[model samples]
Target chain A: MNQISDLITAFLEQCERTPKHIAFSQDDRQISYQQFEQRTKKVAGYLTGSNQCIAIAMDRGIDAAIAIYGILRSGNSYLPLDINNPANRLNFIIADAHPVYIIGIGPCPENINIDSQETQWLDLRDLLISDFSYRNVQIKTDAIAAILYTSGSTGTPKGVALSHKAITNFATWAGTTFNISQSDHIASLAPFHFDLSIFDLFTSLSCGAIVSFIPNRLTLSPSKLTQWLCDNKITTWYTVPSLLSFIALKGSLETRPLSDLKQILFAGEVFPTPQLIKLTTLLPNVNLYNLYGPTETNVCCYWPVITKQLQADKNIPIGIPACNAVLTIDKTTHELLVESDNNFSGYWQNGKLNTVTFKPQGYATGDKVSINAKHEYCYHGRLDRMLKCSGYRVEPAEIESIINQLEGIETSVVIGLKDITSGQRPAAAVVIKKGHTLTHIIKPLRQKLPAYMFPCKFTELSAIPLLSNGKVDYLSIEKKLTH
Target chain B: MKPKIREFIFQELIFVANPDQFSDDDDLLEAGLDSMGIMRLIMFIEDNFGVTLPDEEIDPDNVQTLNALEKWILRHKK
Candidate 1:
């Protein structure tokens, strides 16, 4: 238990200490630490030694939670595939990672094609009922614990692998810094794949706090979402800014009360300035923190926002480094460089990218940051064309490739536009072949992409403007739209 | 109002293609409209139909289908 380098040991210690305490909760169901331990052990028995990489494809429920713990318990890395994503994208991930085991609901989702010989699917119903005792496996500190794939610009998904050492360091740092305790009830709002969930899941477990899930069904009705938080007595809440903004705008929080909330942590995308100000006015007693980190380095810096900080004309500063991370700006490009044990090992099967991402010392975070007068890092934007829409990292080049592959599409380019509610939205501009209308391109694109990735708007272009370098002249297109 | 609702589903919401194929009782969530999409639908309803949907009226069972959506709209519509 004193060995914090191994996350599983630290988590198991909490289970031993508080066996009857609630570990995780969904709508009407709650699982205690003892039950969680037993269930995770059962899942581990089915998956151990079968694959180095175990993929979790279940919905957001108790089964998915057990699968995650079991994968870690089995000493294998877990890859969480979003159940709502397009089958094409899911198939792409399966083909790329080639995970040996896929744990999910029985009967694979329609249109998803997997290599049957290589991949084994384990139904959650069967896994839960298996009569197997907990297996104690030797998990090395350097062994990969989780693999998170982000959108790649070149039409492929790049996986970022985090070792047990990295996540444990982060979880321990979060637990100590946030002062998480058994009395606190933490809300798990972020999806399993997002790095934000790491702090909610591990930090809470490290301290024996109950982790509550914000059900997807309740999210649409902001009032209900607010009600759930108050009803559950969530002391600590973590989610992306867009969801917070949605509640502020749509949820009648002004009339309702949330006396139990102590801390609110937001990250994954830039929070709109006006929404932050509005939120501060409503919840003057709550402590708000703006977290900043890419998937490569999980939450390296954070800003504890005060009322005055929200009113500042400038962007919020992503405060100094946490958990022994050395953050510095590149001299020429001003790109952020992070030297930390918390940084991921490297991208999966991407040796060329490893050379670029994992430099001689640390990971080269492509994000650019500037030091504010308060001596904290202020986010400018990404150095690349990557965009964040609804907290999902998007690549315009990826969408453009998909569009260009469609029949009757001559050329295509996608752009991100700043939106008031969702932070940013993707918009596509396409030049069509003869005998084609804009409507012709919509159906195929919708089928291939998820809802968030779908273009908010589409424009028809006679010809795609280009620079002398033969690259698409994106600046001119942006200017034209503005004019 | 029903026709306008149908048009909005077809035009604004891209998830439903060939609106004629959709039944009145189809579960919208199962049809691929996520939580964000549902919020966007609420905004569209408020803007176009001139109705302010209160918190209680935003229940999942109430807006699960086109028939339910139309009934909900009729109840709230100005």
Candidate 2:
């Protein structure tokens, strides 16, 4: 096994050895290692900025992959902007990250709000500049590689800065643990902005495996996604459990036997045991695993599913530590604390490093947990107000903050409702003024928030429910909504 | 039947910039109707139409369009 301290060095070595090996493949397009290296180099050649932050705004494609790798090669960190996000949200990230270069033909400050005139837009169509004279920049192992944005409690998205050392360690650990090799065909199912893409884009490339990008359209019909996985002969698949659970329920696993699929890894949220059980039974030959981590720490722990001990009602145990994660449970709160080489360097916001208030030992994981007799981590909900609407971490305060700003909304409280498919969906319980109706605020509120964070249900209330100590009565509202 | 499916999809399932202009034949998946939305949509169909669409039959041909969803529901409806 080769020693991997950095991603670029590992990728360069892989390319040199197996230039003919296919690196990335999409619907009709594919790129070899040699071609990918050249393309990434060409992309790096286009940038003239000394400011080492570049924002990429494109859908999940082979080009997006090249753009990301190219940005990394240029000794710059890449921030992926989900094109589906609202302009306000995208603007907030752009303003926060202070990215000098924005790649891909996405949203621009076209007379709306040019927060920075120094911003340069490079269209995705013209990404491959003809100039070959590009000077290579040296990247330190601790240099930020990717900055991923997640919903913040303070009414906006916060960027989690991941170092090259962080990703390389995690991805290398993943590649080694999964026994991935040149022959394995991996699937990239998550969007570029999501943390799950870290494994798909980096680990597969590092292992000299062909990573195939699947589109969102195929997911509407799980059968189509299943067929694509089988037809493409994807050997390994990793994604959030919600989509996988849907596939197991609706994809007719009996008709389409996925012979080539060797293993499946689910992360970002707890897999309901019933669905996990179905996947194990349906794909009897394939191995199943549950990886546990936040975006701040990329995959700190994992469990290889033991189907014999599976129960429908019980939660799956998050396995023992991996990837050199130093874990210590908070005795008082039972909150899981993790420290590792894979832990993110820091949280970034608007050209400044935000303090995460890390303790001497580890970063507080917000989740309340119990160490079972088997010595595995059993998750109990969050210690904070954060909720996972499916795999996307949502802060009700963020949604409520937006809703309160709208007209006719006296005071809005956003709460997560129980959902079968998605773990939870954010619903708004609004206190409206006498003269106005809820309809006026709907359109504007939708524009301010992303689709995932948008409240699925809105119930109009006469007044805000309050506790004895003057706190918002969330428990009362939850009972009212469900009943 | 088409209106009911269309209403449910537009109201709760998918999000499009100009939903009113969105046609009945428009693809819901492309407009951001994900797997979660599909599951909720199936449940809605069973409750409203009193028809249980088999798990294996939840293919693109049945749920891709408003017209397709209506046909799929009506075929099983008494």
Candidate 3:
């Protein structure tokens, strides 16, 4: 099981050794390693075709898990699509990726401009029930494992293509670094589309540990999330910092002793100092880690937040790079450049953008970091207009593009305002046409954007203030919000 | 049980239309209440009504509409 060449091999080896052990679990339902192997094999059998990529639009459950493994087992890469996303965004991804098969429970999106002749819709439930089974399809190490789409600054969603090598490398590094073993019950909190899920999925599988997924419905309910951790006896937990904060403040974590919960790894955004302190106070014995990286580079740097280290400084460092990752700061702009084998291959189908995004060494993370006297990387802030909202990476320009499309909207600017509860939320300020009220464009805006992208608040202005360089005066806008 | 909850929702979720235009049966999610909005609404309810909502009570059947949320508040009230 330790001879990890690729994810499929690592998973299969685990299945061979611990066939009866539970690999994944949902509410009451558990899928053993043997059952997971067989289910994925059935999916792989159906996936035998000319299609190189399969789009999975299933709900966040065992079906989605099986479909992903099945795609990999069939020598095809998976493209995880959130069916909850607006029809426009889904359709756009389908058109761009040109996935040969879409496995999900929902009806086909209307006006889907994909080639109906080539594209086949495989019902996930039917596949789960089917008896069709096949052996693993050999996949090249360099071949893509998955393509996770992220918000692009240029209006269109860009897919970050991760290869089998890249994923396996990171998983190996994480599994060893964290000492994730069969005894650990890992909690899979993030969705499949998000990169955080990769660590949760692979690290658990690689170690032959049980990966318990927190239901999407329960994610918003902080009390339920903490309760789930306690009930499942999840030893190793990895998720966004906001979820931890929510549980600490809103949920009843302090009331009960979650003795089984040992490690809490948080990433995607800066954990608020006060909230982190509160969490540490509650879970005194728990090992806390701050994992940092964009989708393109998985988790490159990790900080083990020891209580002694925290008593001196309120700011948590991003810490040293992972075994396979190298981080260098640009002397000019202080932008963080991450070089790692875990770096994504490139953006899907956007060769022009890919050249700009990926360097020969690694990917250019738009985040800026400062090195302290401790030689640890401390997150300053994002250099670009992109924002991390409720653990999702968002490009403000993308929101602005959607806003500008509305009739009677002259110009719009979206900014992430710091919030005590949910890290940062997007707030939009706009200037509208003379006759139009705010109500006229809000509905259309909602139709186009997802909830996380929705502006927490909207402000009207006669004219959007601009700096001497003609860019929107963001400083003035922040000042206005604070006032 | 409370008009202020509805008022706060309308004010907070400015994307939604006037509160008077909608019936209690209207799906707040469909109307523009996202997951974050739901949390905000829960916080408002907890602070004003002095009620703590269980995780199981936050399902669509209990919180999707104004009527359901009102019923939830009444049931969970301290």
Candidate 4:
């Protein structure tokens, strides 16, 4: 069995043999195999023998890619911090990771500086220009390759440690399943921090296909996105349902028939049946796939969206497990349990592997599911405090923690309220710190949380309902919101 | 002015807003044309008109009525 290092070596060899082939594209800039490999080596050289985590606080572009590959080559895990992250959150993450090095395309925060120990700060453009040769270094399969931090249920971000073997396994499976090859051109739509982007980056690299990073501004504009897709002749598109719905609802598909687009894979949320029907009508030749998984499990199950079949039965099953991924259901609870090569080793910081939830046999996913007569598994809902409302996963604890951060909030509880129009909306019931208006508290909360995570309804309470154990009574809050 | 454009706008407004009642000049933001809904409308205009609308042109006033959208489309027509 070839290890991840072997995969990288093979890819590098292919690049050397065909140095003219385009490896990455961003805006007007394109990087060939020769240039990519040479720059990757410089990054590796700079990071080699570094026994500390490296934080990449750079914009989403070519430099970010090089830094990631460099961290991998240097035998240390890379942590990606969004350039637009709140200063306090960024500080918290930097403090938690305790990164010995920081790479930035622009200026670092003026207020907070990493002065402790030896913290080297390097400009990405300077590093890319430096000439360096590739070094021969062996990498262990189980070694941590990257630590992806996701918004946790407790409001604090948790780092998911991924191994080289796990990433390689996912890449191999994705490349083969999607029929990725040298002829393919895939769009890199998701942000670097988002785990879904890994599929776009590594899968394209493994197959020797072109990976183009779409700018964030273009992604927000429906018209620009449509033009870019058509102009670039993007063959494969991997994005969230939100963007896909934007296209469908905006009617961009009608004018610009994505004729060149052969595959459209959507994950990170439930694809609405109405929008799915519209997409099929617009692009009849394109194959649509609904991928299902959490950040922890990189695409364990997939359901091919056959427009005619899915239209007949409103509910779409998440489908069967991918190659090398095993799925089982807890007979009593019906909670989905997943065992896969792509499963993260464990969360960082706490250093406690969740062996109770995840045994050597498999990890018990908190999502509830049901198997149909055809033996296909369908996602029902989560059994935990997490809620999937309008395609974005909202952790109540995370929202509560943010609410608690406000000065005038004594305590708070966040819960999901199902509505007829929008599938579910987040509602917050707060106990204020005496003489504070709900409006005053809500204004600040909106600025702090993302648009999707914002509470649509605010209910003021004297005190947050608590259970016998003194924990916030989520069920009582839900009932209050529902009523 | 084409009635197809007006009909499309009205139909989309109904689909997105799902209001108990609404007037042609009703503010979209007030009528529940949230960020997600606005995105959907933007796509609708592009597909139907074969013209890409910029983010600056996607305000509530520009999409509140058939007249507003038709005027905007006419100005930006390729």
- The runs of at least 3 residues in candidate 3 whose Cα sits more than 4 Å from the true structure, single-residue gaps closed, are A1-3, A49-51, A106-116, A125-136, A311-313, A350-357, A479-483, B1-14, B17-78
Model 2: how far residue A137 lies from native, Å: 2.3
| Docking quality (DockQ) for each candidate | 0.29, 0.39, 0.32, 0.10
Task: Quote the lDDT for B78 in model 1.
Answer: 62
Write one digit per residue (lDDT tens) for candidate 3, span A1-483: 344556899888878889999999998899999999888888888777522778888666788899999889888889999777887887888877878888887666554445656678878777767777675477788788888999989987888888888999999988898898888999897889989899877878878999988877666566777778899999998888877876776567667668998898998888887778888888998999999988888988989997767742466899989857878888898889888988887777622124235555467788888988989998888888888887899999889988998998998988988865556888888899998988766667777787778886787888888999998899888776545
Q: Ten consecutive residues with minimal summed lDDT in candidate 3 chain A?
A: A350-359
Best by lDDT: 2
Candidate maximizing DockQ: 2
Per-candidate fnat, comma-separated: 0.21, 0.43, 0.19, 0.08
Give the alpha carbon lDDT tens digit for every residue of A1-483 in model 4: 254442355567568667888989998999987788778888887665643478798777788988887877777778887655555666667777777678987556663466556566777777766766556677777777677777688688788777777787888888888898888888887778877888886888777888888876564456567778888889998888767766765535677887788898888776767777777887899998988888777788998876767662375789889747899898888888889988887776632223225765587778899988878889887888787655556687887898899978898888877633234567888888877776666556544665556676667788888899998887888777655
Tens digits of per-residue lDDT, candidate 1, A395-471, equal 88878887788888998888877764656677777899999776755667766777777776677789989999998
Candidate 4: which pairs clash? Answer: A250-B43, A250-B44, A251-B43, A251-B44
- Model 4, which residues run further than 4 Å from truth? A1-7, A111-115, A130-134, A350-357, A389-392, A417-425, A450-452, A465-483, B1-37, B40-78
Comparing 2 and 3 on lDDT, the stronger one: 2
Q: Per-residue CA lDDT of candidate 2, range A1-483, in tens?
A: 756677788899889889999999998899999999998988888776543778887888888988999898888889998878888878888888888888875455452244697667877557675666678777788888899999998888899999899999999999999999999999898888899999888998888999988866676678778988999999999988899889887787988889999999988778889988898889999999999988998898899999998999898999989898998889999999999999988888877556566897788889888888999988898887888876889999889888888887788888888677647788889898888877665667767787778776777788879999999898998876665
Cα TM-score per model: 0.91, 0.93, 0.90, 0.83
DockQ of 1: 0.29
Off by over 4 Å in 2: A49-51, A105-114, A125-127, A355-357, B1-33, B44-67, B76-78
Model 1 steric clash pairs = none
For candidate 1, the TM-score is: 0.91
